[model samples]
Target: MSQQLIQGNEACARGALAAGCTFFAGYPISPSSEIAELLARELPPRGSVFIQMEDEIASMGAVLGASLGGRRAMTATSGPGFTLMQEHLGYASLAEIPCVVVDVMRGGPSTGLPTSPAQGDVMQARWGSHGDRATIALAPGNVQEVYSLTIEAFRLAETLRTPVAVLYDEVIGHMREGVVLHEPTPEELGRRTAPRAAFSPTFLPYEPDENGVAMLPDFGRGYRFHVTGLMHDERGYPTSDHVKVAELLERLERKVEPAVAAVPPERYRLEDASVVLVAYGIVARTARAAVDLLRREGIRAGLLRTRLLWPLPAPALTEVSSSAELVVVAEMNRGQWALEVERLAGGKTVLAPYLKAGGSVITAEELAGHVRRLAREGVAVS
Candidate 1:
């Protein structure tokens, strides 16, 4: 292990290189621009390809194309650019292209703040793309996790044959921390599943294995198949047949279900607590501190910090919520993910939200104050 102080965005770039990513295409965007900049400086030296595209849409298109050509590819951007890439995100989901997307979140909805931090993109990461599709989004609370989760994002993308997103706020993206950067072992660096049988005219490029991921052959690898944003059949050809379309969508979702366990939530001091706080990304650090403050004040507070955003870690959430009398969902947004927690929360637990926006992070003192008020007044904290 090599220990050094590094910024979160720089750690993400190094993680991608460690994961064997050989291609990158992205547009310059605040907070996330460092990721693209670092990759540009490092990739070419390692014989990898890096390009600054015209825009986010073109960047995503180039990434998908590179992945199809058998290169481990990725791109990085912020809220505005992320919005532009939604169309390609949907296409990648339906087409089963393996790539990584890093979203270093800044204030949003329309270039609200470039240098400030906010978690406004939480819901967008999962639902920005149209239609019913599964999403794999990882949230790292610190610089070390930024490195680890970035590598995990690429691993999941390859094994599941889908795009995986790495999300963090501007604070996390730019903050520097001491971390031991470890190289991934061969097994840790997962490989995409390739076609098992010899390629022939009868080959089915979209046919799934028992794991539900298709054996997609790389382009120029003597395997030819159709690729489109429309619903596709087992042979990778466009198919509007109702049964095939329905099955395709269902399989797309079902295949990624294993991610729930593969990337489980971090349960902290939840073994026997009456108050539980839920948070992720940079807010999670503050929330954890609030838990300690509450515990010291005789509040029996615990925290559930999720590393994986999508596929929601429902069971873990429900189990913790069931045992708690109060569940506080703290975030750096206008109650985006809190809505999901409210839906999954146990019927017996009282849920409260501590939300902040306008490019400010939820501070530990502020969160603890809100929880103190909520615990005493039994009213929701606005």
Candidate 2:
């Protein structure tokens, strides 16, 4: 492992390169711009291609095209740029294109705050695209985790043959920390399997084997295959048949969610605690500190840090919330992930929310104080 002090955006760029990403097409946006800039500098030396697109939409489109052409591709953006890429993001999901998207979040809902940090894009990352689809999103709490999770995002995208998002707030994105970045093990790297029997007429582009992922041959690899955003059958052509549409939709979900159980949530002091805190991304660092301070103050407070935010890691969340008396969810947005946590908890525990917006962060002192007051107010533990 080589040790160096780097920002989260820098780490994400390095991680993508380490994961064998060969093509990048992205627009420059605040906080996320560094990721694109670093890739532009690093990828070329590694024999990779990096281009600054006309906009986020074109960036996403170019990424999908490159992925189809057999390159590990990615793009990075912030609030406005992410919003612009939503339609293409949906297309990638529907087509099952393997790519990674990095969103270094700033305050949102029409360029709320450009340089400040906020976790306002949680729900947008999951459901910004239209129609029914499943997305895998990962949030890293610290600089080192930013590196590791960026690599994991690429690996998951390849393994599931779908787009995976890596979300970080501006605070973490620009914050520099000492990290010893290590290379992925052979198993950690994604293996691109060649399509069986190239040029065979019997080949089905959307026909999933046991893995529920279609065996798609790269473009120009002797495989004449069709790719489209419209609902299609197993041959990859657009179709209006209800059964074919249902099958394709079902496979999209089946291929993504079931396999996500392997990605577990990060926990701290939750084995035996009356109060639990839920947080992710940069906010999670403060939550952890608050938990430690609460424990020292004789408050049985624990933390459940969500690294994998998309599938919601329901089983793990349910188990933890059911054991705690009060579950407090903290985010930079007003109850985005908190709402999801409440729905997942399903009345198993009391859900409380701590939200901040307009680019301000929730501090450890503030979180600890809230927990102490909540505990003192006698909010029945169990």
Candidate 3:
């Protein structure tokens, strides 16, 4: 490992290469374009392919196709571009293609801010794709975590044979930090296990092998199969039968839920604290600073920083919720994770939110003050 000052987007691009990514397809978007720009220069000399697609949709589609063709593939975009990629995101989910999508989130409903920081896309990262489907999203607080989590995102995509989204705020994406980026070992690279070419007529394309996930066959590998956006059967054909649709849905959920459970929770100073602060991404960095300030002020405050966002780190958050008198969710968005903690806490504890949106990053002092006021008056900052 070598310590170097690197920006998060550059780290993400390097992480993709370390994960054995062979294809990059994306349109340049702010706060994320660096990932594309870096990869564009790095990949070709690496015996990999880099493509600038016409739009986000095409970029995503090309990435899915690349993955299906047995290449580890990825695409990067921001809020507006992420919105445009949702349809293909849905397609990747239903088709069971393995790819990684990086969303360096900015302020948004649409074009809210192009060059500023915001964590407003938490819910969108999970449910932006139209139907009921399972998704994996990872958020990293700093450049180092961004590098590691980007590798983890690709690993999860290949291991679970599903598309995984890496969510980071604009602040983290553009900011530089000192990072030790170790080269991945062969095992750590996590290349997909290629399935044997199905030459027999009886080969079932989508039939799962006990893990609730089907082995993905490389394109042109003599495997005959259909890939579509519709609800598919074990053979990958479009199926509208109620029973088949229900079964497919359950299988998809089963494949993803276990991976979420297997991700280790990250806890800080929560072992003996009464007030627990919960956060993720760059916002979590501020929340950590606030925890230190609160402890210095003689308040028993701790932090539950979650890197995995889609699964919501419910068990860990709920554990903290159960022990704490109050749980404060600090974010760059207006109460996205706060609402989730409220639902998971379920009357066990009071949930407070310190939220900011539209490119405003919440300050450490503001969060510490919120914790102090809550401890003194038993109230959330409004």
TM-scores for all candidates?
0.98, 0.97, 0.96
Give each model's clash number.
0, 0, 0
Model 3 per-residue lDDT tens digits across residues 177-271:
99888887765666554555545776667777677877768788778778888887877778899998998888887788755675556788988
Pairs that clash in candidate 2? none
Flag the better candidate by lDDT, 1 or 2: 1
Q: Pick the winner on TM-score between candidates 2 and 3.
A: 2
Tens-place lDDT digits, model 1, residues 239-293? 8999999999999999888778888888889887788889999999999999899
- In TM-score terms, candidate 1 sits at 0.98
lDDT of 2 by residue, 1-382 (tens): 5689999999999899888899999998897889988889999988889999999999999999999999999999998898898898899889889999999999878978999999999989989999987888999999999998888888888878989989999999999999878999866767655566667777788777687888787899788989999998888888999998998888888788853565677889998888899999888899999999999888888999989888778887888778998999999997899998899899989887888887888999989888888877888342
Ranking by TM-score, best first?
A: 1, 2, 3
The candidate with the higher lDDT, 1 or 3, is 1
> Of the candidates shown, which would achieve the greatest TM-score relative to the real structure?
1
Off by over 4 Å in 3: 193-197, 379-382
Q: Report the C-alpha displacement of residue 7, candidate 1, in angstroms.
A: 0.4
Q: Which ten residues in a row have the lowest lDDT in candidate 1?
A: 373-382
